[model samples]
Target: MLSQPLSKVLGKKTADELIRQGLLTVGDLLHLLPRRYDTWGELTELAQLVEGEHATVQAQVLRSTSRRTRGGRPAALMEATVTDGASTMDIVLFGGAGLMSHYAKQLAPGTTVLLSGKVGLRRGRRQLASPRFQVLDDLSEDEREALLARPLPIYPGTDALPSWKLAIAMRTVVDQLGDEDVPEPLPAEVRAAHRLVDALTAWRWIHCPQDEEQWRAARRRLRYEEAFVLQAALARRRVEHESTHAAVAWSLPGPQSLRADLDAALPFRLTAGQVRVGEEIATALDSTVPMQRLLQGDVGSGKTLVALRAMLQVVGAGGQAALLAPTEVLAAQHRASLEHLLGPLARGGMLDGAVRATRVHLLTGSTPAPRRREVLAALAGGEPSILVGTHALLNESVQLPFLGLVVVDEQHRFGVAQRDALRERGGVTDPQALPGSQERRTPHLLVMTATPIPRTIAMTVFGDLDTAVLDETPGGRSPVATHLVPWEREPWVEGIWRRAAREVATGGRVYVVCPRIDVTDEELTDLAHGSLGVGADEPDTAGLEDLVSALGEDPSPARPLAAVTEWAERLAAEPALEGVGVGTLTGRMSPAEKTAAMEDFASGRTPVLVATTVVEVGVDVPGATMMVILDADRFGLSQLHQLRGRVGRGDRPSLCVAVAGCEVGSPAYHRLKAFAETLDGFALAEADLELRSEGNVLGAAQSGRRSDLDLLRVTRDARVIEQARGEVQAVIARDPGLEHHPDLAAAITERLDEESQAYLERA
Candidate 1:
């Protein structure tokens, strides 16, 4: 009954509106929680109004009028004169010829209403502009007081139905559905241990909390439920996935094997951590059960090398492997890195493909049609090979005949669906039936992430996969010294360019990163849409480098950021940087141009590369020791760390200069300061989680909403999430199919719908 269409529960018109806004079923409405609660029990008088202060006031409408906008647009303005017993104020509501038309008639003379909005002064006349009002018609003072006593839920509104209307509809739904009608998903024993109430009670308190504490407790209960259901589903997936049959059984041979040959051919010795991680992956490859593991290492911790070893394990078993990168640049980089590491084995040595031998192929959007067809043909054949590319690899037309292993670089950048696509490359659904079937088997999965995930996040967001951390940095890598340079200090600002010039003079390169590619209002609109939970198009590139910074709206809402073009132009004309060659790179740059700019910077043709955060990942220039990030407050904590990591790759001592425009003592200022003080990515990741929460951690590619886990915060509610996960595992262990816990099964099914469950399987 709860799964019935909204049209069956609500009216067709209301259902249409809800469905248009992506709220379809009755359950969706229950989860369409209030963004906040407005406590209007304490009302201010008209005389007490302060400019820019949000307030609620009880006033009587003396008169009302509607007029066209001054510019003579189709829009109109609805105005009203209202007064409390103490003083009078104006209510200006901007509208169309029909804007707030319904309200105009209702706001007739002598009508009493409750008005709430930011107080403003228009030509010295105190007014409430576009205030939200509630009619108090036919209501006694006692009734009005009683209505105000309950916290008013402010929901996320849509064009068809305002927040107030949503609140009304939800109240109706809650009233119709009795507390007993909504069964408790969690077992009574579990709920008692966690001190949680029933789901129905939680919904009631959430939608109609009598007080702040009530709403908080209600939210807590819902958060636990969401985390528990998701964790339970993931735990079951892990169990099933680890028990599945492998398509290719690959046991690492002795000292004379190709794996040994490849390892020996590498120029540098593997770190102890790398050797340990490699052994773990090798063991998983040897198992009949397919591998689903995460390899997390700091920037340049040899993740590619570890991934290559796993890919070779599949190759040794006469199966192909595909590596998925988030961007074309990163994909191309991976292809090049693999080819370099594999040395002669990639071409004709041991794991070679001289015609029928093992081969390595590169596939990307930029690859010519003929070359793409060639790569596709090679993958379709039975010969063992390694294919590397971006989302192009996930295209339905691309076929991997005997693909037994999959490696995803910057796995977090891709959505769960894309990973699933890659993992299902061999075209076999049931790996368990591999013993009888001639069909190719499922691939062993190895996902690599350069961004360090917090422990709490790793447990919940990627709880399904086994994790391996590459904690040690390779030898000869210099530590990057970070410093916070306030923009207000002119001398310090001038010194940055001088320092860049000095670095260039010393034969070292410099990366000068700006917040914006160009100064435009499009950024504002993009940001506005993103903040409203609308899907915003991301920067189209490979390796999902600096996406948060590229898609990032301003961290400091009150201030604008400096643009890359303007900064590059200024630097070109600066006397201090006259001798230094400066080149600019941004998302707006053509693929060819970006490549050329990177080449120039790398080869010392342009010693000073003034670019955007596009250089945040996978652009290795060991010679570039100095990085200056302008308007640094515009970036998040992890982003700052990534930008800093771009430098400090070589033996020379490196320095990162972060220029922050934020006012001292501000949150942005303190955040930048904290980033400048710490080089530890893991610590900074924890801090980042606290500051921004995990936005779109799981559904980043599938959805536009920044953070999908609205009610639960991974950082603050780690204990709750962990406890829920444990309890869920225990429950699922006793009843794998959840037959014994029908309520939990139903709830998990509802919460983790088919689409969501499919995505989580990829995770």
Candidate 2:
């Protein structure tokens, strides 16, 4: 019973209170895994140490000096000298004596201390500052040497608390748990079949592993747990709610309804792709099993028309439909386009009179209560026929009278829960429920996105779903002629702007884009909120303070990048492009404001729109054929591709200029270059994933898109993810109840941690 709380680790009792939330248990502690492991073991003589070598040296502190800032503790500056058998080396410790009070107070001026760090030559002087130090106690030389060997785990930590300290603290607690957390839920026979370890052993080995041998044991256990719960939960709920759910195979008003709608809506001819996809959708909507289809296309590839046509079938069958988009802008775009494309269908009564009107109701967060209530009523009464909205449609208050189909736009942005929310609107309780009005009816789904999926990935990722790719763009829209300019040759922007200004003067618009609105580490209190989403990331104010304090006596370095308004100001003030009214738009801007800014650019009111990626998704300005991307290398290929799509909308020939600054090179350069060379978005998406760094893939989990993982370079393990998913599905199909397969259930239970579930197939 030597169990002390995490208070010892965090230096505060408050964090220990987190144990009450189940985060302090040894099983949970083990799951707070290390991001990396760094070893500073190669003990070498200072004279023998080469530049860039991470060398460890035993040195004696020769002298110490101290200084105080305005009100903070005075940092002690230490200068130490170390020697081997033949030569001596000078080691400078910038602020160790005073800053690290605990360490300094423990070691005397002339004491023998061991330093571990990389050797660097600064201005011809060998330096070893801010090196981690260990005081030699009564421990034997071999014991200390063993502790310094190989790599030590680096836990995820905050600035107030370092990872090394966290690991040490965790190790102490884990020692008490001995071999496991809860007992293994799987049968012994199943463990042997899958060649897996019991749950307790897996977690125990994961956190306090003696070697890499335990990595798979821990990982598989966690992965299984995550997948199993998600699947089982979905299944359990689906079956429970099946009674009220109506699984309607066909909602069409027979051949007469389609013929009448098509006959009345024949203003524009459907492209072959659109026609084919429409038929496929109709067939899916009329099917027995719940339909899950993805309609993929490049920008302006005529996707909205296909979606609208599918929704029309629900209308034809006496049922209502809803279209959900990720953002207000996108939702609005879809609403506008949906109205125009299905105009003939919505007017309902007349076939040959005035302009055809589609009774497509719009629902978003900003919608007035009166209007939303009206829209909701209309939807229940099947008056609007179809509804278009953002996540507001998923609200519990939004009732569906007879919802037959639900279309999710930018489908990848949503997760299983969000999609399931809309699917459950018609009343299918969960996945196990058969089609029809039982517990809850289920609606057919048509997921659409502007990004085309690679055929192979699409097949595996959406194995159970049908798919259609809109590969061609409409005829009149010209392909943008793209050019790539290296960082040093960024002056190409001048040439592009001069030419762009000339074009705008003759009635065109220009879009100037940067990778980020502001890189300044400080967030403006006014502009820190996310426009469309409910929440945002909090600033690490404490961490920032600690970093500044760690700097000893220098002013805090500014974070790079300018915010939207600031960027707009700088672009407008450019002496070379004076008087070019520059408007700004970003996630920081209000939806109404962003819409207004975009409208200005579209109407040629603002000739130059200096923006971030906000304009990359929606906001079509056909007049904006001239796009100048500053610091293109900083953007991912998929993003660049999306930006490139902003133009080339009109009949006019469009131009895109991607400019890179000299300082940034390497992989980024190649990525931008690849995007500039091809207009193919799918190719760019793959390249973007491949070239992306660690932060891009794993950081957005808080946004509810945790399932979006990248195994680009880890293509070797892709088969494993697919195998797991398929195996899970097959297991469920064979044994809908876990009563028959204890081993599979056990494996899944072990792997279902928050992080594992988030990454899942994508990781």
Candidate 3:
């Protein structure tokens, strides 16, 4: 019955309405938990009602009047004065004559009613305009008392179906529900251990609770159930992946290998965190079970170096490794960084190359045809080499027959399918293999993210992968000081340009970050007419939308925001920055343009580079000492931290000035203030989680399809998630296939959709 379509139970019209809200099955409707509970035991005081505020009041109607308007179209107006024992207010309703007649008969004098509407002041008297009211006189004495005693569940509802209507529909369905409808997903022993209620009882109490305690208990049970099913699915994925997948076991490099030679030729010693994480990756690479590891580190923490070393391990063992970046800029940057770091080792076929070296090649969407063919041919040759590229690497034509390791940089930018596609492209089938011999192999995966993930998120989202953290920076890396500047303050705004000029004068580079590439004509018109601020248009990207909404800002009629094009042009002509070369970089720019701009900035020819978040991740300029983020509030805390990380890479002390356009004390402003106060990526990650929703735990941040997580909050449910993880691990340990827990298995299947299941499998 629970699995049956909602239309089978409720009438078709009502069922369709609920289905439109993503509640398809009876079980889905049962899980549509109430947003909150409203109590009728204490009615809102009429005298305390504030104008323009929504209020729900219980009172007795003392007098009533009905009249027809003489104006344009005939309309009926009904007015009634109501009063609690202490004070009185007016309720006004406007509608057709038939509706007014009905309201007049229903709201007769001496009738008790419960009314809800926005309070307004008319002729210096408080009144409710077109209030929704329920006549209490119709209910029996006992029912009236029951209503006053028990709290009413208020669900998240649409305009056509209010909370009260949803409650009625839920009650109708729940009344006919039986034990078989909501089977016990949790085992008896597990329920006893956790002090949780049965599934049926939880569902009943969650929707129609007798008291606050009952509902709280119900919520707790359901929250745990959500976490348990999620964790169980993840555990099962891990079990299946380990058992089914086979990978090349690349051993630790010998003294003369490329990995060892790179380490020996390094200009600086490895940090303790890097050394520890490197060992973790090395161990995973040496396992035939296939490596599934996530390497997360703070900005400037040498994550790239660690990943490079792991890739070299595969190359040294006579297998190819691919580094997948999310953008062409990052891919090209990675290629250049690898070449610079490896020096002669990256030029294996050249005369000046190291004897035991291998080649490093780049393949991007913009790669020239001849060069692209050359890279593809080299990969198909099965010779040990390192290949770096963007999403183009996932193309069908790009194959690595002897691939042993895959390193994905800025892992979150790519979807699960993209990552899996690259992994699936590794190793060819062996037709002559014996029955027990490994028929095919997948490459080991090492995904790196510079954005530190909070503990709960790491467990919930990346639970299938082993995690390694590089928390320390290399020696000689400069410490960055962050400051928040209000955009409304003119002196502070002028100081930004002056500071950039000063940094340029000292031969240090500066990065000026903007939220958008350029302003649109509509925005320019709005600015010229002073009707709306610049960037009044909605954010071009969903990320900015989510950030703005999470910061509690209305994206419509957006505040004035900075743009790379406008800022670059303005700064180039600024008196303070006169003759100080300013360059522009945005994602819309061609690869050559971006590279040239970055090159000029790196060489100090263009001391100031104005760009968008395109340089958020892997752009390294050691000489850059200052970063100015215009409209910093438009960016997420993690993203702002990443942008700030572009500087302070060298021995010079760095500073990051975040210019906030949000009002002082707003959520976005506080977020920027927090970013300015701390350089700790982990702490900022937690702050980021608090300020924003955790999004879809199963997939990409904003993928709404798999975001069925209504009860389990990754931010505030740390203990619950941890407990669920432990319980799941123990259960999976006892029953590898969950064969003994059919109900739990069913629950897992019900909770995870096809996309979510696929995500977990690929994750």
TM-score of each: 0.73, 0.64, 0.86
**lDDT values, one for every candidate:** 0.74, 0.60, 0.79
What is the lDDT for 405 in model 2? 82
Give the candidate number with the greatest lDDT: 3
Give the clashing pairs for model 1: 247-441, 326-543, 327-542, 327-543, 328-542, 353-357, 696-706
Best by TM-score: 3
Candidate 2 has an lDDT of 0.60
The predicted structure with the larger lDDT, 2 or 3, is 3
lDDT string, candidate 1, 130-177, tens digits: 888889998888888876776889999965698988988888777777
Ten-residue stretch with the least lDDT total in model 1: 528-537
Task: Extract clashing residue pairs from model 3.
Answer: none
Error of 1 at 423 (Å): 3.2
User: What lDDT tens digits, residue by residue, belong to model 3 across residues 659-679?
Assistant: 877777788877887898899
Candidate 3 TM-score over all chains jointly? 0.86
